[model samples]
Target: MSITLVLVVVMAVLYAAGVYQMLERSLTRILIGFLLVGNATNILILLMAGRSGLAPFVTDDGRSYEQIAEEMADPLPQALILTAIVITFGVSAFLLAMIYRRWRLANADQVENDETDASVREDAAGISAQTTADDRALDVLLESSDEGTAAKHGESAMTDDRKEDR
Candidate 1:
């Protein structure tokens, strides 16, 4: 097959893979899809530069050639791809960091939308401020008393009772 056709096929496959990956739930997979898409774009650009019989750079024969003279791969596309790669790396790193932070906070990978209406209703009804300082203090006191009673009975007391009943 011609180089152009081969490149076009490669680009199409990469694009399809990228789209499929983007549809996945995992953020990591989405990032991989983005990278694939970026690569496909670079490949398209390189293909469009047109095929020449020789490289664009100077030769020892001293023909004094200008850039983009013949069949050699274009250096500009390569440079642009490198820059795009760096940018994509930075963006992917930032996205991963954001996902990590969200996971750490919520203990889940999926994004959760907030129920603002419920929150607003609670706020309007003064439910948000219903738990007073005294109630909180009492909860703490009760919890401490429960723990003290447990400690007094010994940690294995409950387990021992179950064994005796059995």
Candidate 2:
């Protein structure tokens, strides 16, 4: 097969895989999907550039400037690809940081569904604002009670109680 055809096929595969991966709940898979998509886009830009030719550098050859221009490869696509690479790297890094933060906060790699999202949708569809406010207050109250219980018992009390049972 021709190189262009090969690249086109690869691009199509990457796009399909990327879309599938992006739909997953795992943040790592989403990041990988983003990378695949970026690489596929870069390949698409390269394919649009046509066949490779002489570099755009001006030489002291006797050939006219117009002839040299005709023989030279387009530089814009390469430059665009380079910019896209940098942007992809930056975005990937940001996503990685967010994943790490999420793992630290929730102790899980997969993104959990937010209960608040459902509640917000319900509220938008006519649920009263007072109900949402009461839910938030209940959450805060439960959290404070849990923290108070932990503080009142302390680590030493739990360890001693366990030792007695053993």
- Whose lDDT is greatest here? 2
Among all windows of 10 consecutive residues in model 2, the one with the lowest summed lDDT is 154-163
Error of 1 at 46 (Å): 1.9
- Among these predicted structures, which one has the highest TM-score? 2
Tens digits of per-residue lDDT, candidate 2, 1-166, equal 8889999999999999999999999999999999999999999999998879899999988999999999999999999999999999999999999999998998988988799998888878675677788899998898678667878877333356656886
**Candidate 1: lDDT of 13?**
100
What C-alpha lDDT, on a 0 to 100 scale, does residue 101 get in candidate 1?
88
lDDT of 1 by residue, 22-87 (tens): 988777788789889988988887777655455456666655455435546667766777887788
Q: What TM-score does each of the candidates earn?
A: 0.55, 0.71
Model 1 spans > 4 angstroms off: 52-55, 66-73, 113-166
* Residue 47 shift from truth in candidate 1, angstroms: 1.6
